[model samples]
Target: MKTREISKRKCIGCGEMKPKKELIRIVKNKEGEVSIDKVGKKPGRGAYVCNSLECLEKGMKSRRVERSFKMKIEQEIYDKLKEEIVNE
Candidate 1:
């Protein structure tokens, strides 16, 4: 049987291409809810980022995440993301 291909996505932080399965997905839902999509199955505009804190920092520094999501990001969300990344 042929192997099914997993999706690939590029990180907006460091401009690195990574498999969708390997990267963390951030999404803006239809109702404008922005959060991490662990299942990679969320509906709405999505952006990929590395699971690394460094990449997250870069993304935050450049506001790449906000630009990609087309919305303002809340500081609390960033703090939560940071905490998650650090723990991981």
Candidate 2:
């Protein structure tokens, strides 16, 4: 019998390695648009963050998320992400 390998990703916020499905995905498409990837199927550069506001704040403070996407993140985007984390 063959065993399946679990996919893992590092959270840009908390810097922890966790199962991919357990983290939330944020994507930057070719159009340079950034948005939360709820389905994880958005085609583009993707960054992961833990499903907690603390982690999100950490990432924001350290500018890790901005570094990952190589772009400036707006307050509106962070606000949306915060809302998503709270709802989750």
Candidate 3:
């Protein structure tokens, strides 16, 4: 029998390693657009965060997500992410 591998990702907010499916993916595509990747199948630079607003705020305050993407993120983007997290 073959064993399946569980993919793990680090959360930029809480800085914890967790299963990929349990985290929210934020992607920056070739066009330099950042958005939440609910399906986790986007081709771009990706950062992971927990599914909680607290983690989102922590990532925002620490600038971890911005550093991960190596660019300046706008307030609108953060707001969008927050809304998504809340809805989830």
Among these predictions, the greatest lDDT belongs to: 3
Candidate 1 versus the native: TM-score? 0.87
lDDT scores in order? 0.88, 0.93, 0.95
- Residue 71 in candidate 1, Cα distance off native in Å: 1.2
Give per-residue lDDT, candidate 2, residue 79. 94
Error of 2 at 40 (Å): 0.7
Candidate 1 regions off by >4 Å?
1-6
lDDT of 3 by residue, 1-88 (tens): 9999999999999999999999999999999999999999999999999999999999999999999999999999999989988988
lDDT of model number 1: 0.88
Model 2 RMSD in angstroms:
0.8
TM-score of each: 0.87, 0.95, 0.96
Query: How many Å off is the CA of 45 in candidate 2?
Result: 0.5
Candidate 1, position 77, lDDT: 92
Model 3 has an lDDT value of 0.95
lDDT by residue (46-69, candidate 2, tens digit) is: 999999999999999999989999
Tens digits of per-residue lDDT, candidate 1, 1-88, equal: 9999877899988998888888998889888888888898879999888989889889999999999988899999999888877776
